[model samples]
Target chain A: MTSPLVTVTDLKVHFPIKKGILAKTVGHVYAVDGISFDIMPGETIGIVGESGCGKTTAGMAMVQLTPVTSGAVLWKGRDMAEMTRSELRALRREMQLIFQDPYSSLNPRMTVRQILSDPMDVHGLFTGHQRKERIDFLLDTVGLSPGQADLYPHEFSGGQRQRIGIARALALDPCLIIGDEPVSALDVSIQAQIINLLKRLKRDFNLSLIIISHDLAVVEYICDRIIVMYLGKIVEAADYASLYKNPRHPYTRTLMSAIPVPDPARRTRRIILKGDVPSPISPPDGCRFHTRCPDRMEICHKQEPAMRRFGNRHTAACHLYTDEQAEPVENKPKAKEKIS
Target chain B: MDQKTQASILSIQNLKTHFFSRKGVARAVDGVSFDLIPGQVLGIVGESGCGKSVTAQSVMGLVPNPPGKVVGGKIFFHHRDLLTLTVQELRKIRGAGIAMIFQEPMTSLNPVYTIGNQISEMFRLHKKLGKKQALAAAIDMLERVQIPSPHKRVHEYPHQLSGGMRQRAMIAMAMSCNPEILIADEPTTALDVTVQAQILDLMHRLKEEFSTAIQLITHDLGVIAEMADQVVVMYAGQVVEQARTVELFQHTLHPYTRGLLASIPVLGHRTLGKDEDLVEIKGMIPSLYDLPAGCRFSNRCPKVMDMCKNHLPDLIDMGGGHQVRCWLHTREMIS
Candidate 1:
């Protein structure tokens, strides 16, 4: 296998919580804490988590939109963390992000043509006729007619607006695209269209994509590999087949069960996570999922489990799969029973 | 089946809800019709701008005044034409007979007012109860919706509650008067999967308890399959297909409905491999402002014919309460 186009190591984004008249930094919200992953060239890596699990923050940190507290964001052998101002500006052309809400992401006042051409103008990529030609090409590439370039965002439907967002992201022919819940906001029928478009564009452009979404089904459709996050940690990371077929982590299993099965007759026992997600400001001490984990043990309550590798590509941060507690499924309960 | 079992609690016939926009007349709900039977859940599934929502708003008489106009159709509620009712008469039936829970609970709820105050206001206005009596009723309603510590929660404002709690509060408010019918327009769309499951389960339990007919309008097929007793697939402001939930899933006749079912990527299903490709229905939903003369879906339909372009297809009954509006299906039946 070739080297990954982008490699993120120990990426942490913390927001300071200030208070009082002096506005002292009292604490910090550990949004994305020490998450590490890689995006292979021309491959899609999906990041799935519940709301406020810091998936969006992780994506933002990758693109330098959010300040990273500690980590090395190595882009093609070069660390983005060490990139200078001008270098970072140049890197922006190769790393583009498509926001979730097309309505808010795109400038409502600007026409589609103006919105698509803004990136080129900022980078000084093309001039005059060349720019006009590129804008029309992008519009056509995204399944929109050349005539639609003049229309504003509001005039288009949600799907069309999203296409414009995609076109804008591809304006500079970026090597990597970070789609932050891109299709979650669109209608299901329209979501299929956008997903297909993204898949086609990924192949056509040979782009490495990091898709951040809460929808497991959407992720299952598009991503080659997935990293499931809980609270502020990656609980499980595996290829799409293994993650769905045999989810190791309790949270991943719960998330898989939560996806609504379209066929009513095919009844799968749903593993309902008991409580609401804990506050990110002050996450639980041990396992972040222990609060709602069905098979939580006393050891799980006191000790934070480290991420353990299983086989070649699968990795999970759970006590159940750890080598120290290598026991059968039936005997696993005995360990918890003894711990209690 | 008994005659009364087939009776529709709410029946909308030939409904045409139009919005007079500055650009042109937007046919948001152009000639939509459906029946909601008692103790049944009718799922209205459609993409955005397909007029499923407009049809719901038309039923509730909640269409915005300036531009929206119900030009045609009779909305019969308990055999009484809702469109013909006076403002005072409709006001009396609004919450007591038919209640609606919108998508965004925060927007629907008053920010300044406490949850208790808002809930009690429904009781006071409709039931003509005293302040103290209404407050008790409000607390009971809150407790019934499974809100933890109803007394404490009732005092909190809408902003104080979480998204799931807010939706529960909204549901509590809607069911306070023991309404005959509940209209949930994408109630769980904005919520997370777990919250959405809980909401769907709550609705299921509430239906069994109250025996209230529900009209669920959403774009999610998964939600529809889970909750709906009957399903109505809409496209371009018309009911393209209608069938029992299981029947619709098993034997989808209409091309649009078939395409929709195929498009959804189900869990445990085969993934789209390198060789495998997704079957996307091409072309956008035509602008409601200027829809084509014939079948609206003819433009995007893979099995479209010359006849489909020339004339609109009538929703023909194909037995077992399955109705579909497509020339291909009609032709197959005729042949």
Candidate 2:
């Protein structure tokens, strides 16, 4: 089997909180506190969480857009942190990030052709005539007409602007595309068009994608693997099938139940977690999710749960499970005290 | 479900709001009509530029009128035509009769004022309460919206509060007056999923407890599913489909409504193994100032007929309180 395209091991991105005049570092906000995952070639991995959960920071760190506080991001068997300036520049071509807000992400002053051509110019991919031809091809690949290349970003609609963003990400033909809430800023109908475009691009380009979004529904639509994050930590990680069907961790289950399904008659019994996600600067001890977890145990308050493997390629950092091969058929553990 | 029109807490008929811009007359809200039944949630779901929020603004008399005007339509509340009311008369009914909460709490709440000071203003203006009593009422309102530590939070400025807390504070101010009808326009759109759930839950509890009617306008169908009793699907300044929540979900007559529903990827949808690419409504929303000759959604309709291109479809009633505005459904109405 081929090795994974990207591997992120124990990645932690902590931002310092500075106080008044002195600008002294008082404490650090644990944005991506020790999260590990892998993206196989041509596989789409979804990192799902709420706002301020650090999914965006994690994505930025992987692409070197944000300075990583600590931990390792292996890019094609080379450590991203240790790479030289030239090596880092080359690594940029292998990983591209599609930002959330299409309106602000693209420079208003630039034309669609300029937006698509800048990356190629930066990387020295092609010259004058060849670059223009490539720009036309890129715009066409993203379902926009080549004639519209002369128009500025303000002339296009939100969906068209997003297509331009996608074309920019694909300018270098990167193997991995990390989209941070790619379609969150668009309307439902426009969101559909963009999602379909991303899916088609993935298949055609054979690109591995890390979709960081608060929306699980959209994530599940195109992902092969899923990770549920809470308070800057992964509560559950599994293959798409197991994660959706089983959802071993209480946090994952809460998140699944919380999603507002389109059906009216079939509204699921919502597990509305009490209170907001605690401040990430000083996350709750033990399990990060225990504060909102309904089935939290006494042990959950004092000890952080290890990753318990229940299914093939499925693991959850929950305190409920014991045996490695146990099916976890019953969610409630009768043997141990379950603090409801 | 055919109730008396006289019983509706708020009734809107053929409301048309136009904006006079450099380009031309932008028909933001074109002949839109809906009613907020007593203690029920009336949802207006639509894409951007569909006039959902504009419809809400027209009801609250909040439309900025140098370039905007409610040129037509009658909004009848308490047997009075709100359109005919003077600015002074409208202000009398604004907070006490109908209160509104916006999507962005930071912009809505005054930055310089304390949370209690802002909320207390509602009590002072509507109830004519003294400063001390109004301050106490503000804290009570904060508690009602589930904001923990109301005592301390009431004194803090809007910036000191988190996003979720600030939203709850906005709700507290809206609820302070105890209005007959609450018009919430995209109230939970800016919030996170968990916070959104909490806010929606608060609205539901408040509705049940106070029996206040709600005109809930949103782009999210899921929120509409969970909250709305009557659903009105809007497209480019007109109601495309209106029905009881269950009927709208079950039958979904309009092509635009069907396209909107199909576009959203429902969670756990593929667990039963019906995997396929998302069904997209091709093309963008037409510019309101220069819309198509007929149906706004004509360019994107999958079952577009030649007749749909030049003729506007009527909002035809399909009985059982379900209404659809589409050429495809016009035949069924004729039958």
Best by DockQ: 2
* Residue lDDT tens for model 1, A1-340: 6998889899999999999999999999999988998888899999999888999999999889889999888999899989999999999999999989988998999999899889998999878889889988999999999998899999998899999999999999999999999998886667888998999998899998899999888888888899999887999999898888778898888888877787766545677655468889999888888888877887787889888877678889887765754232445765453222
| Shift of residue B248 alpha carbon in model 2, Å | 0.7
Residue B154 C-alpha lDDT in model 2 = 95
lDDT, candidate 1, at A157: 87
Task: Please provide, for model 1 over B1-335, each residue's C-alpha lDDT reduced to its tens digit, 9 standing for 90 to 100.
Answer: 22532498888889999999898999888788788999999999999899988888887788998799999988989778999999899988899999999999999999999999999999999999999999999999988888879999989999989898999999999999999999999999988887787788889889999999999999888888888989999998889999999999999899999888888877656442422345787877888887888899989889888988879999999999999999888888989
User: Residue-wise lDDT of candidate 2 within A1-340, one digit each (tens)?
Assistant: 8887888999999999999999999999999999898888999999999988988888888888788888999987778899898989988888898989999999999998888889998999978789988988999999999999999999999999999999999999899999999999999999999999999999999999999999988999888899988888888898888888988888888788877878899876788878888999999998888888788778888899888787678888877777655555455655655554
Residue pairs clashing, model 1: none
* Residues B54-145 of candidate 2: C-alpha lDDT, one tens digit per residue: 99899888899879999999898987989999999999898889989999999999999999999999999889999999999999999898
DockQ of candidate 2 against the true complex: 0.81
